[model samples]
Target: MDRGTVGSAQSGRLLVEVREEGSSAVVTPAGELDHHTADVLREPLEDCLEKGYARLVVDCSRLEFCDSTGLNVLLGARLKAEAAGGGVHLAGMQPVVARVFEITGAEAVFTVHETLDAALAD
Candidate 1:
């Protein structure tokens, strides 16, 4: 894989990293998040909910791509969390991914932050 290219930093595929900070949960998703890797986000998100985390932050700083499938996963997670009286924040979206949200009119539905710290603070 070529260095500095998209999705090359961690095996040219999606990598979801989850951690807990106080009562909040952080899930940092890196790499492509099209149909093939949408499920990569599901488990960690579900785990956070199962662990009773009411505050969730999804750090998208390293995410290289996202398709409709990826968007669906995010939407589902958002609904599930909000239904449970919790909410999810999207952090550090790349331009391409952010455009997808904009095109789909999902930007208004999510609480998007420019950084993980900002998301966590909210």
Candidate 2:
């Protein structure tokens, strides 16, 4: 149940918090997830994988905005997780962010949940 922050105040536009939940690593990213801030999310995700956590849950309840770069990061993580016999699950997406996934057909590729509890339950 260790929790840590991955983003820095000086260079990071996004704030990512990492926590362990069961066998999964939960990454909560807040603020804008654009090209400039994608690394904030990426670093924690990679760390989770390196630590042998293949099941990832991205709690997007506080995520205010997301761009194509953000989507790309998630997709790449999904690929890596799946290759490791685990997967990336998304939960609590905002309308705008959800629309981005829907428009890009990424919704079909990801397992979306209505809440963090739901994601964890699955």
**All models: lDDT?**
0.81, 0.89
RMSD of each: 6.9, 2.3
Q: Per-prediction TM-score, please?
A: 0.88, 0.91
lDDT of 1 at 11: 33
lDDT of 2 by residue, 1-122 (tens): 44444333223568888888878889988888999998888888888898898999999998999999999999999999999999999999999999999999999999999999999999
- Determine which window of 10 residues in candidate 1 has minimal summed lDDT: 1-10
Worst 10 residues of 2 by lDDT: 2-11
Candidate 2 residue pairs in backbone clash: none
